[model samples]
Target: MPASELSVRPLTVADMTRFIEVDNIAFIEGPYSPDLVAWQRRFLEVERSIGLFDDEEQVGGATIFTMRLSVPDGRLVPLAGVSWVSVLPTHRRRGGLTKLMRHQLHDLHDRQAEPLAGLTASHPGIYGRFGYGRPTQSVTLTVPREHNTLRLPQGVDDVTLRLVSPKAGLEACRETYARRLTSRPGMIDRPDFWFDFETDDLDQLRGGQSKLRLVLAEREGVTVGYAMYRTNELGPAKGEVRVNDVYAVDPAAYAALWRMLLNIDLTIATVVPGLAVDDPLLAMLEASRYGEPALRDGLYVRLVDVDRALAARTYATPIDVVFEVTDEFCPWNAGRWRLVGDEKGATCTRTDSTADISIDVRELASIYLGGVTLRSLAAANQVTEHTIGSVRAASTAFASDVQPWLSTGF
Candidate 1:
């Protein structure tokens, strides 16, 4: 509780070693591979990485990654991705975490570069007070190899499957990835380094698992899909095929990629991790124990510039209403605003008219991606409807047909 612990400053690449040490300690996970740390250090934006120091011994730190996030109607909005947030155990409850967040929020509001700020919360409850809401959810499917038999769509026989080195298959894999990027809401843009990180495939980084493998799906000699995976074995009898990601163009290609993994010899189960809530696999298999999936929060979004975040996306229907939004954390957004336009486009501006709905900015974040609806939040009393018929009208306008998903983690 001394004044020395109150010191805060931006972190440079040079400070990343100490930063990661304090960070991994806080997370209780890693002394990550040196290769990974080096790549991560280079990927950092020094000016945006804030650190709380106690006489140069780092006590806490957090940083924002500058990226673009896909929103409704295929619009890409600027995203300030909050990552690596941590406060050392020795410094717990001294307000180090609070200082780190307060500094980051004020910085985001002041800079105005990214209209939205987001994070994958280590603890879901920590960021709501900072005006962040759970806008996206990710699901994982674990199917017993025997139960992996899916009633797949037609055209599986027409697709050609090939196994190649990760390096050899990069071109085809990236092509398939590009096609899926902007199709759904909540996808963050991946830079070159992200690709490197995902496919690094080093033996040292494999831990106890097998080497990373690549499988490409081709049709008429053109690549249509790909999967990056590895198999984990428990002695000679039990094995699990762990798939990192799978992307495909058509139902056939999708089926073929999954079928290949499902049929892996001796594997007890096929583990498909990090997928959209409405992932095709969920619909492919019958309702049974095979598709046992775990659901959890993925991305948390906070609107730094409420107006820009609202105006940049397309709405599903038409609605004109004023929202009385509260954000004591970022006070600039705490005001009544009128939004007009929908489907084709929309605009939101400050207004003096009475509010149609009153909601906290965090709740507003929930519905922003069209993943969660105003009606649902209102049902839980998280969103308050003041005008007659406003809840149904606004919910209809803000919703998207497909669920929002973000596969990449910050």
Candidate 2:
């Protein structure tokens, strides 16, 4: 088919089966079922979505979801999240993916969205071209069989930790997560996030459809911590337990959650977390050897609109700086804007702004989740400094103490 023959448009209900087929071919996995495709289509129809087709054959697709991002002072800012991007293999290098992304970003801009987009990248290298960058790093730690020395804290006695059905435990999990997500940066939740906490298919388990057990740590009949985990045998006497996610409001509860999962009867070793960059789980263990941490990329964020994205996040310190942002794909974000921050909050506005810093849209995304610093990017030449003092102050203010972590992948 000729390039001009291809067309891009909003996905419809009738395209469900073809969408699933295209996605499976694109991802090289069979996780997307017809029902899942239908659900996704419905979700897209209700939200902002786009698709590209080559003569009736689905080639690419992307969806955007809304989230209320909580700033430092307990203010919730509306955010537009992008996810589930895919392009058919045969359509690679044909600009199908780029076209779909551009359409989605333009749609987001028209909706008065602040141009914040988040997704878990299938291929880390692919998104930078579209002005997306890694905002957070995920650490996967593996505990050796001989180093399993996790113990429950003293005075944490009388607390009971038991496995419960995902269905029975949905409300508790939601309650525990709600508290965590609000206080933390780079975390977002939607109303339907807890709709179905359990599913029968293994492939759909990531979205709550797995045989994994939910362990709730209860003290005085109140749940404080919870972990979703599953154990499988790698070989005889060699078992692996993977923790999907574990959260606790207090130290004792945190320790108790780890103890219960580490001591799961048949498992000799455990991979207990998908931790944030600053997770203390490694230091909490008896020895660092007990938890060998491995780093991997997590969430990929893009600033659809620089001003909106800058104003949406709460700064850690009071500072002022101007950024000359360049975006080739989304031209609306390509300009200079003055960003002001103080103990009160932060705001971005257009001005005859004299820039203290300059960077591409990609670098801005890298710093959006508070993981990467402007100074570091500046040092690497990804960001250029005009006024050193102002640049340093602004960068420091945007930095977050708690490293970003996405509890769930798109």
Candidate 3:
């Protein structure tokens, strides 16, 4: 198998089975069940998937999902979701993975729809070489039931909370989730297939836990928030409730939902899998002897269209700066760009002006959502400051009032 003979192309309908086999082999996972394969066929866009082949045999592949990303100031822009990426073990180290990724980027660029591409990294070191940066941090918090006290906010009780079957509450949850996506940064819009997968076909993936329970909060018959969770046994007298998904549009609704999770009967501890670093639940806890929160990388973002991505978000303050960004993978993003904006809006244009800061596209993406600051990058020697006050000004302008968080991982 000569490297020169390797080719990457979109998967066809007839290539579905071979693609799945390559995916399972590359990931070292057992063969997917027949039912799972059928589900994959339903949601997977064969045209958007790439197959890396040596001669006529598939050895590597990946898939892209059309998605919407919620950026700063509640701007939802089209995004490309990359997932199910793999290179067969036998094909590793032969440049197959690189070919697949480069081809994927070029295809996305040619489409000209999504300005940004995002993926949750399976390995920390793989995507950075391709110009992806982790912008959001996800925290996993475990609170003992005894310490799950809610110092209820005034009027929180006015919000009615009730338990409903996942089947019955799917529509309301979908509407509330749509509102949450528009109002929050880093959230991704969920498609109908996603709802179907989460509510119906996800039990087998839940590790033998009880069936998922849906909790909804409403005021005047309008859905405001929801929580989806499952309980597992910790011991005879104690149990653990794992919250899979949660969304709240209003403060009272948010507080009310947490109240329900904290007070679920027979559960001695609650484990929240993914929450923002600055989630309000941290401050809402009245008292607790909880362990330190475990923080991990959330979304890895790639700025496919630098100008469009930079101009789409609102800044925190007025500032002007020129950045020389190095993006070897996406050569279009390389060079100096002048960005001028305030809290209302921003404009980014190509410039020959002297660069106030020299950085890589990965570094730029890290701070794109305002979760990681330029100051922090400077401290780590990841950013170079040419002007004395430019670093602070740039950091402040890009800062977000609420930390960026990904509501869903593709």
Candidate lDDT values, in order: 0.85, 0.73, 0.86
The TM-score values for the models, in the order shown, are: 0.95, 0.91, 0.94
lDDT per residue (tens digit) for residues 56-99 in model 3: 98888999888888877788878789988988887778888889
Error of 3 at 75 (Å): 0.6
- The candidate scoring highest on TM-score is 1
Q: In candidate 1, what residue range of length 10 has the lowest lDDT sum?
A: 1-10
Cα misplacement distance, residue 83 of candidate 1 (Å):
1.0
Summarize candidate 1's per-residue lDDT along 1-410 as a digit string, tens digits: 54554677898778887887788889887568777677668777787888889887888898888888998788888898899999888888788877877788777768767888889988888888888999899888888876766787989999999999888888777778888888889998876667676777766568689988999999999999999999999779799899888899899999999889988888888887778988888888775355678888999998987888888887888989899999987888999988887878999999999999999999989999898999999889998888989999999998888999986889
Error of 3 at 330 (Å): 1.6
Whole-model lDDT, model 1 = 0.85
Superposing all C-alpha atoms, what RMSD in Å does each candidate have to the true structure?
Answer: 1.7, 2.8, 1.9
Poorest lDDT segment (10 consecutive residues) of candidate 2 = 193-202
